[model samples]
Target chain A: MYRLTGVTKRYRRGDETVDALSGVDLVIEGGSQLVIQGPAGGGKTTLLQMLGGLDRPTEGSVELDGTDLARLPEPRLTRIRSESIGFVFRTVNLIPALTALENVETALVPLGLAAAQRRQQAAEALESVGLAEHRDGLPGELSGGQRQRVAVARALVKRPKVLLADEPTGDLDEDARDEVMSLLEGLWRAHGLTFVVVTHDSAIARRAPRLATVRKGRVAVRERGPAR
Target chain B: MFFTYLRRELRCHAKAALAVALGLALGIGLVITVSSVASGMRQAQGRVLQSRYGLGTDLTVTKAATPPTRGSTPTFDFAGQSGSSARGDDLVTVQGSRSLDASVVSAVTGQSGVADAAGGLSLRVVKADRRFTQGQARQGGDATGVINGQHGFGGYGGVTAGQSGGGTAGQGGGSRFDADDYRAYGVDVSRPDIGPLTSARITSGTGFSAAQADGRVAVVDSGYARRNNLAVGRSFTVSGSTFKIIGVAAASADPAAEVYLPLHQAQALANATGKVSTVYVRATDAQHIGTARSAIQKNIPGTDVTTSAELAAAVSGSLTTAANLATNAGRWLSLAALAVAFLAAGLSTSSAVGRRVREFGTLRTLGWSSGRVVRQVMGEALVNALVGGALGIALGLAAAYAVSCVSPTLTAQVADAPGSGGLDQGGKAVGDVLHIALTAPVSAATLAVAVALAVGGGLVAGGCGGWRAARLRPADALRPADALRPAA
Candidate 1:
């Protein structure tokens, strides 16, 4: 479960101050899939970052599971991010230097899991995302769709409570986007984990259980979508 | 896992580490070689100095420069002086000339620290009035008996530099030779306790007997005998005194006295009895040398009192120049090398850290602390220093070997004068030839310092470079290298 009360974000560009998000509040229950749709520079990524606790809210409070994320210190915030949230960024965010299996295992290390258990869990996560055959393959060796699948596996390997995706389909072709979306939906349905995806794509908005349209640092409209 | 990351980065940037290692090797190698050579030369020179100055003579007491006094200066106006009987006190000392007088000699002999004392008047052969008449035909006097040549233990020939020429007549086949210039060394050969002739070696004929020393019997070096075309038992007639060549001992290159005689006879010969140019003193115990030195100096004011150590220091004047070069120039050069090494190491490590900013950022994201990051960087720098140190030591040894190859040893020239008791005045160095050795005096302490310098330098440089890298935030991982760096 997550809650946001009048979350506002501001950034400095040289001498000029720009509003990134302003006076926007939203809440979603656990095990629901929410998609935030907006044009470029429309505060969707900023809102997602605020929800993931990567960046603090400028003038509001963001709470997850009854704990305020903005008030927590950096170490505790880092602990929250490591244990509760998994990030899947836009460009198929897999470290080029590591294999798919290692990239998944990298997320498990903060959990204090031993090496053998981490390897087995990482292999299972890769299998769930249909990337078990590509476990030993590097990001450079994998196709765009396979790389995105690897990112999904890494994000879910820790079995975090919330999965944050920022324009997951932004850099992928139609076929790859379909594959990554289907994988996310299947994992969310099976594990009953919260999934928040931010994208400009209409197909992702139509597929999620809820859709919020953001414009000019505020959400213009909120509506219920088809079943997740 | 940390090393795995480090190893990957190292493989990606192998050239950087190599450059650092090479730079350090040059600096450390130079310091090791220079210090080893300088230290080795000092050890060799010490041995040579000990051997040059002979044994048993604990301390030497010589005449110091006379301090200027009112009316000490003498003016010889022939018209005013012709009628004035030449009083012994009237003879003023020569300018820049240092000689022992009767009072100084007697006072030195009476000192409590003096176990025994003997005097010698070192005289040079300034002029020769030869009467060489082939074989049996003697022009000036009768032919003296031929004394066969023999080898006797000879030491530094007392080459007295101040007096021109002086001596007394030998009571043999010839008459007395008298002149203020005709000279022979008068030593107290009668007393073996402090005699200058105690360490003397004769290469040709016999040494003087106790009776002969009181007489005008003389011992000459082989070189002197060859130069004068005289042999043992031949009559050397000079200043109308016939000195029968009682013996021909081995000669120094330059000798203060060609012949040895009794101390009293030499004082009698020089027309100045109870006076000597040099006196050899023996202490009752080795530990009393310093006491003897202080006593002699205190008793005889304006005298150069020298211990055996002082004599050794005086004999090693030339090496002092080499020592200065090794000390001032060698140390400065090593300092310069250290500076260059520090800069090279610092700059290279700084650059390496800058290039890996993103790598550090990723590690932080992976739950690694800033402390862990810093330690990794320092570890790499330490490894580089260790590699360089070993290479440097090897190179330094090679350098020493090369130096030894060029000149195995260089002769150290020491000149002993009659007045100073440097027994060998031939400019001959007495001990094992002075040479540079690779391991003569192993520079363990200096080597330790060299290693510490390298490691300490590397650690400082690494810490500096690492501090900037460790402070990097995880946000650094967001920017790709190309975006952060402008197109070259």
Candidate 2:
């Protein structure tokens, strides 16, 4: 679970000060899905970064479970990210030099697992993402949808408590985007994770049980009906 | 995983890695070449000194030769000489060196750092072979006729002039003579280890024995012996004394004498019973030669002392110039090249890291510690440096070998004692210019230095790249506007 109270993130662009997030208070229950939607220059990614402990708020506390991530030291925050949180980004940022299986193994590297165990777990993660046959393939050799699936496998390989993804399908076509969203929903239900996704795609936003729209550094929450 | 990533990255950027490696190699090669050539110069200088002073002679003491006075010229008389063929040999001190008391050898031996000393007499032989014939006087105007091969009938004819009509009979008889001259040294037979004989090797027959110090025996130089067709067991007359030839010696490239005789015998022949032309001294400690020379000069007045170092300093020509260049200009050039190479490698590595900002940022986002990132960069740089080290060693070895193969000859003109035409060691004129072949030798120490420089160069380059990688912020992973977009 995550709690944010009066969170504000500011940036200095030359002589001007822009507030990426201002006086935002939000709560997310555990094992639930939340979709954040916003336009360009909005605070959607900033909200997700705060929730994931990737960045600290200027004047608020971001609590994950009972710990305030804003007050945590850098090493502790990195540890939390490694052990309890998983992140996926659009464009599927994979090391071009590594194979698909090796790319997934990077997530488990920080866990201090033995090489054999890391390899076995990475192989299993590839199988779960339906890229088992392409585990030895480089990212450049894989199709767009297959590479995204590899990224999903990498994010979930460590089985963290939460998954934060920014524009997870922003570059995919309709068919590929639907395939990725279905995979995420299945994984969320199966693993019971606190999944927060930042997306501009309405198709993904409409499917969320709870959606938050961010505009001008402020957020308004809405409860949705059954998926339509 | 670390190795896998490092290997893969290096393979991906092979061109950049090769550039850095080649830069380091050139610098290291130049260093090895310069060092080896410099070492060769020093060895050549030592050889030039050894040729003149013999293997173990550390210092030499002598008195400068003085010009002869009006009545001091040597004379040879053949009056009432036996047989129609009369011969005489005159022994005198070498022209360029004066005689010193034989006691100076013992005095030098007693000095500090003087291990052993021996006195040697340098002498010259002026031999005259003449034939006197009685000629028939003509009862005419000149009353002279040529007898045997004489040019003028001067002496014998005049003696008979009083009995002749015109008394011109003395001008009819004359003599024909041939003069032969050669340089000789009188070595102390008891202590033959420190004098002129140390520089030569006996090729046939034995050298002078201690029992022959007072006996009439001689060792003839091979060059002089070859010209005169002389061999061992032959006898040569000097001042009415016949000395038996006991041995034949082949001298060094710069020979010191044509013949060697016992010191006592030489002193008797020269009519200077207790005089020697030179004193050769061997120091107890070679490192303190200057101390020994100073002591000898202070204790013994009016004596000239010369050391190997002093002789080397007097040497000038191509060898000296090459030595100076190797030690000065060559050293600085190698150092400057290395500095530039290190700088280029560092900048190249740092630029490589800059091009990979997105890659490093993703690793940071994946929770890889900054330390791990730095190690990866360092590992790559180290590999490049090691490759460069190996290449540099090969290049240096080849260059040194090439230098040795060519073996360019360098000339060294060693000056003699001040105002003394040359060192009168047996009147051979010791300090003439010599030609020596130059060699480049690469020692193990030079290779060790090259290895150290290679490693140091690697560390410098790695440090530059690693520092940049460590400062990367994970936030750099997200593009501006904080929204993911398709690649252009």
lDDT of 2 at B126: 73
The docking category that best describes candidate 2 is acceptable
Interface RMSD of 2: 5.9
lDDT for position A184 in model 2 = 87
| iRMS (Å) per candidate | 6.3, 5.9
Residue lDDT tens for model 1, B85-144: 221222222112345775665577688777777665654333321111111222333233
Candidate 1 chain B, run of 10 with poorest lDDT: B169-178
RMSD of each: 12.6, 7.1
Off by over 4 Å in 2: A4-10, A15-18, A22-26, A43-63, A68-78, A214-228, B53-312, B416-431, B477-488
Which tens-of-lDDT digit does each residue in A127-150 have in candidate 1?
988888989887889998888888
lDDT of 2 by residue, A71-184 (tens): 998778778887888888886788888899998998888889999999999999999989999999989899888889999999899999999888989889899999998998
Model 2, residue A106: C-alpha shift (Å): 3.3
Q: Candidate 1 deviates by what RMSD?
A: 12.6
The chain A TM-scores for the candidates, taken one by one, are 0.96, 0.97
- Residue B269 C-alpha lDDT in model 1: 49
lDDT, candidate 2, B1-488, per-residue tens: 88777887777678888999999999999999899998898888766655445568888888754544586655666674423876664545553547788888899999988998988887778767766665454544653433333543222321334233454443344466666777777889998777768767899899988888899999998888898888999988777888889999885545566888898988888887898878888898878788899999999987888886676777677998998899899999999999998999899989988888777766777777778888888988888888888888888888888999999988877654322245454543445677878999999999999999999888999999999998876664455544432211
